[model samples]
Target: MLDLWDGQLRDIGYESMGENGISGRRYFQKGRDNRTYHVHVFQVGSPHIERHLAFRDYLRTHPIEAREYGDFKQKLAQEFPYDIGSYIQGKESLVKDIEQRALEWYRDNSKLRRTTQEE
Candidate 1:
């Protein structure tokens, strides 16, 4: 059986998981409704995972940002509750815009240390 943790599944076999055996990498999966969902879980020091966690932390620390994110998500869900199959299909430009905005926000607000700093 698949086990869910944060944004990653675990304890599944290689075939069920992937060739890499879940060395803390991001992935995607389809639910019972056949809707695609992104999965993310990374080791403590993993750059990608750290960035994601840092963004989450920043949001948590900044209630206004978190509220804004929640409001946007709620509006999106309300507008496309049943459009999962096509929600991201032809919205590459929109996706890019959102990504750029998120990155800029994180860069400006996150307190995560530089990845290259000496430990």
Candidate 2:
């Protein structure tokens, strides 16, 4: 998704790149008002987008799980306040568990959707 912050969109100095033996998706990064913004645009219907949305959808329907995940992440960030890699690594197990649940949820919902359409 395209992300814009503060000011008008005009002064974002937007720059984007794709393919050319360099990328599968469009990506952009720019500095405006002393802030740098980076946004990645995934292809529609791509698995990457599906995976992302699936977790979000699962969490949306499960507030307790979402809150636990958020708290875990906050604790990780505190421990690795300046270490991005460590922060990501710390959440690997939780992410995997959540992803499995999300996949199951997607499958169940898709089946229900098809059944409704048939009816």
The candidate maximizing TM-score is 2
Residue by residue across 63-113, what tens digits does model 2's lDDT show? Answer: 999999999988997898778679888999999999999988977998999
What is the TM-score of each predicted model, taking all chains together? 0.45, 0.69
Clashing pairs in 2: none
TM-score of predicted structure 1: 0.45
- State model 1's lDDT: 0.52
| TM-score, cand. 2 | 0.69
Q: After superposition, how far is residue 42 of candidate 1 from its true place, in Å?
A: 2.7
Give a tens-digit lDDT track for model 1, residues 1-119. 12345233433211123412445564445453333454554545766664555556666676876786667655666677788545444444544555555667677653345543534
Q: Which stretches of candidate 1 lie over 4 Å from their true place?
A: 1-39, 43-45, 85-119
Task: Return the lDDT, model 1, position 87.
Answer: 47
Candidate 1: pairs in clash? none
Residue 35 shift from truth in candidate 2, angstroms: 12
